[model samples]
Target chain A: MSPGPARGPRALTRLRSEGSSPEAIDQLLREQRVPLVEGPICTFLWRGDADGVAVDHRMPEIPIPLPLRRLKGTDLWYASVELPRGARIQYRILVRRGESTESMNDPLNPRVVGEPIGSQSVLEADGYLTPDWAYPDPTVVSGELVDLRLPSRALRRDAQVTLYIPSRMRRDRRMPLLVVHDGGDFLQYSSMATVLDNLMYRRLMADCVVAFTHPGDRLREYGASAAHSRFLTGELVPHIEGSLRLRGDPRGRVLMGASFGGVAALSAAVRAPGFYGALLLESPSLRFTEATPSGTFGDVFEPVVRFVNSVRAHPKKVTDRIFLTYGAFEPLAVPDRAMAEVLERMCDELRVMEALDGHNWINWRDRLLDGLGWLFPGEARLIYPG
Target chain B: MRQVTLLGPLDGVDLAAEIAAFGVDGPVALVTAGWEEGERNDAEVDRRLGGGSRNLNLYGRRLDILESDPGYADAERLLRTQIDELRELYLLRLRHALAGLEVIRRRFAEAQRRPGSELDAAIDAVRMLDETHTSSIAAAYEHFYAQNPPHERPAITRHREEVAAIVAGCAAIAIAGGHVGVLNDCLHLGHLAALIEERPLLAWSSGCVAVSERIVVIDDDDPAGRPDEIYDIGIGVARGMVALPAATSRLHAHDPDRLAVLARRCAPSVCVLLDPGDRLELRSGRLADLTSVGVVAEDGQVLRGAQAA
Candidate 1:
């Protein structure tokens, strides 16, 4: 039966009449439904055969089990939490059914993003609106994509890189270059090629070449590895510059990536000063240390944490324009905010934006238009007429 | 040497003072093609140039050719009618595309279900429509020029020689602003692109639009309130920039989205803001480092000439 208008403070009477427990009725009301934005709190409700329910989110400091309580008179379970606007996060519900406990995606949420481990339901907080131009415009000419593999002496492996060339450029012309990390995922999942095409056709940026470099060993290479940094600066950059008609000046080059790739992009910039004009870091994995009750450093992720800490300590080493973004709902918010603070002092131009989406390709995809446009606007073209 | 010295406006910025900075000694040539009816009224500009400026009067000179030649005026009138009709039809299509874009943007932002693929389709439709319109405009422009090559006609050819003679003696050429459309049409008619070679040129306001690679018309708060459209291709003397004169008054500076769109629309080259006191040296068709002035940054901030440093 369809949910009728509420009669009083207690709602969902139809679900209750159907022999559904309070928890089940609550789940029915809350499940899959967009959370109503009431000031600072988003109230979430869930109902099922489980005796108990809890939300497990990606935030590092938040407790693992944020238990949902059932109403005293009804079988419905409810929970409320304060969230900043534009916080996009992935979350799972931990349900206790009879003798077993299980974690699963929200059956009510239609939006989801795939992860290396598994898919998670997306939660977009009220605040950020995706720009209209972020969507692909088919009317504009699309860039040509060619796949090529290069042997990397630094990493001792073959690296696959996809090249995107704007159609407007002549064969003899040398264009600026944008190098994207975690290239395969960005191309396949982020719809980056479409973004580049629209941005170029609109003349929001210069007609340039883009190199999407796929990693051989993502987990290791993306986490503050010197070898990976060397491969990018030594082997890949030189190869692309020599083979393609790309701008030789470093001021025309930009490096972009998300998550571990964000860290990797920054690491490369730190390693090779004056190599890139700008760096676009989306939800960069900037955290490296864990503090105990005693207020001392505890367990750490070795190289990744060490690299992040060193960069934070010496922010002036990388002077290019830094474009940083993070999701307010994710645990990475703490570290990303801290990094933004440090970057503000060092870089001449630094823009930090917080989105209402999670740490996924979708979030990164939304940032490409703004990030790339700010990083590389060609010589000058007219956009407004008086 | 191919040199271009761009200024904000001639209203306050003295042409003689500017020419003095260039350190050129000979008489300065003036291109008043953009002034339309007043193209011949160069007494003030001449005085400002220390009485050594010779007005090319491209606007009146083109009319002189058409009026003097038998049947040329009739042919030109017919072509004008055809172009006007085409422009009207293109503007109609532009309205629809802009309306469609507004709808898609609203729906994409408000819909609980992210309108991902559908939003893309709508955006593409608008782009396609714009592209189709622009291509048609370009084709029509080309056809008009083909049917009437000024070099083949006697009256027009004779006027071109006179223009060339005036340009030969001048050390620099100065272009003043007026209505951009009128300015661009007159410039094309006189073929200043061929005549202004090697000599340093000083241009302000609509003159910038006349020489830019493309002409984009934007009035954020127009009575009709339409999205900015690419009107036509320019002479491309100023290769990378899209010049917006009287920017502070005409543009909606406080609106980031509006500013961002404007900044993006003219990428690569800076979205040049021709405000008062702004002087830029554009060399080899690209803006030079030290003399490059005022640009609209992607962050919706206007970086004036001083900030260019």
Candidate 2:
């Protein structure tokens, strides 16, 4: 027998009863299955009003087999949406759930300190904010296959590395270098070059060199394998230094990537202290499981933990600064929080921010400005130009 | 150098002796038992000496010393002090040294601004001295003592030389290099990959167990009587389907069964190293005892012959 819906507080009638409407009951059940935001989400507006806020709920375009529903009950709402694994969306509710007529301010708004209930407040989606240092119109300088060979061992097969340098450059001195992993996706989706150009035009960030590294064939090679670390420490760094004519100091070096790349960049910094002072991580895949061992990409997580622990134990050995951002909706948020806690405990200066969205390049790009301001504040002065 | 002699049980005596010998330049200040025991011994020795000597005596005058005596003290005491004091002077130096050594022994196991060439030179000096100075291995105790002098240095350096030689030989074989990678508690296939990548590696028993391609997967840890799986051996060279020396049988009871299965499964003939001084020479993929090393056994039946099958 099919389970029944509640008639009252305690009584229930079976959905398959002779006179029952199974479709309606099924719909109701489906509606109830929609998940709500578990924790609080905060939004900060650089420019916006507190009134006339309306949040539009847009369902994912993909077809989902399971019956999904959206239910606004009490002070929260639940929605069954099929989102891509790493996609992020920014939204605001049209009105408060409980207060039908009230124009109350969102309690989760970071900008609003205090607002009485029943007061209508406006919510808006902030445009994605690229770092001022991002290339405004990044022309692909060249995309070529590069081999990463280990210096100490010849038996090891070399990994195929792809390097992409943004064509936009300044005439003055050498530009700061930013090395990013997952070059293919970064070149396509991140809009990193455009962001760099805008930042440069505005004088927010100094002219910087960016090297986008393509992940190798093996998933482990890019993410969890020790060879990945070696590739970065032994091969990639030297390659960048020699080929790009980039400054080799910590201040001039930066590493950025999303998901596994996020963890990989951080791992590289840990393995080679002072190699990269600035790290931009987005929705980092920091979780480790035996079934899906992190070793596939490279031994990123444990080495990071060891390096951070040692740094925490001996602060004198660590001087690299970090800027980390994560989305609340990301599946790896819990692990990301754990990583953040570790970094917080070790670093003398660390900036961490949680977005009011899931793991998406959209949210990552949106948060880049803030992360960059904190990481390269002097660059900000260059962008704003006093 | 300052010298220190730790008086306690045998568990950590070797380490203590090594440290004392390397750390101090002077004769080690001996402390037997606890502080109370040492004080009692001091009183006994003083009484025996008719209260005329300030020296503390141990082992019936085989060793006698004063911490401040100029005769037996070394330079280590002058260079460094007690462990606690040394740690305070350096940033986690003591803990790092201990942790580093532990990591080198396969036990449980960044960034900075640009410093000038002078700073690099200073650091290079220390690194050079650490790498060189084979004497450091033997003089560890003397070094400690000299930094934190407790007693006078010995008149001869032969003892230091002997200790150094032993340490050099052992360290050369045991420690691969100065790096050690600490992984998570659980075993992961990625660790094997990392090992191949040449990151100094450490792994628990389960970690090692999973590395081989073929393994007798025993279910001893399970409460239920579960079957064992003979899986493919791991990629590590140290592990394979082969017979272990007879001496290992005392340590592992399942060795016979494991060996039998391996012999049947492996190609190119299987060789077993038996204890009691024996070698088994293989001919045309068959096993035979060579040099009358030890008796052979198959299927719980012992075969006694100079050329046993």
The count of residue-pair clashes in candidate 1 stands at 29
lDDT of 2 by residue, B1-309 (tens): 111111111221133224333332222222121121123344542332223222212211212222333343223222222321232222223224433432332321112333345433443443333233323322554565455442223422333333333333321100100001111100111122322222112111222222223222332222111122222233332332233222233224554433332233332323333342333332221232334333324332223344433
The lowest-lDDT stretch of 10 consecutive residues in candidate 2 chain B is B172-181
- In terms of docking quality, how is candidate 1 classified? incorrect
Q: What's model 1's overall lDDT? A: 0.71
User: Model 1: residues >4 Å from true position, as ranges?
Assistant: A1-32, A36-41, A59-63, A71-75, A170-173, A289-300, A312-316, A341-347, A378-381, B1-208, B211-250, B253-309
Residue B260 of candidate 1: its Cα lDDT? 53
Clashes of each: 29, 109
For residues A70-159, could you state the per-residue lDDT of candidate 2 as single tens digits? 221211222233233333443334432344522334334422211111222222222323334444444323223344433423115554
Q: Which 10 residues in a row give candidate 2 chain A its minimum summed lDDT? A: A377-386
- In angstroms, the error of model 1 at A135 is 3.2
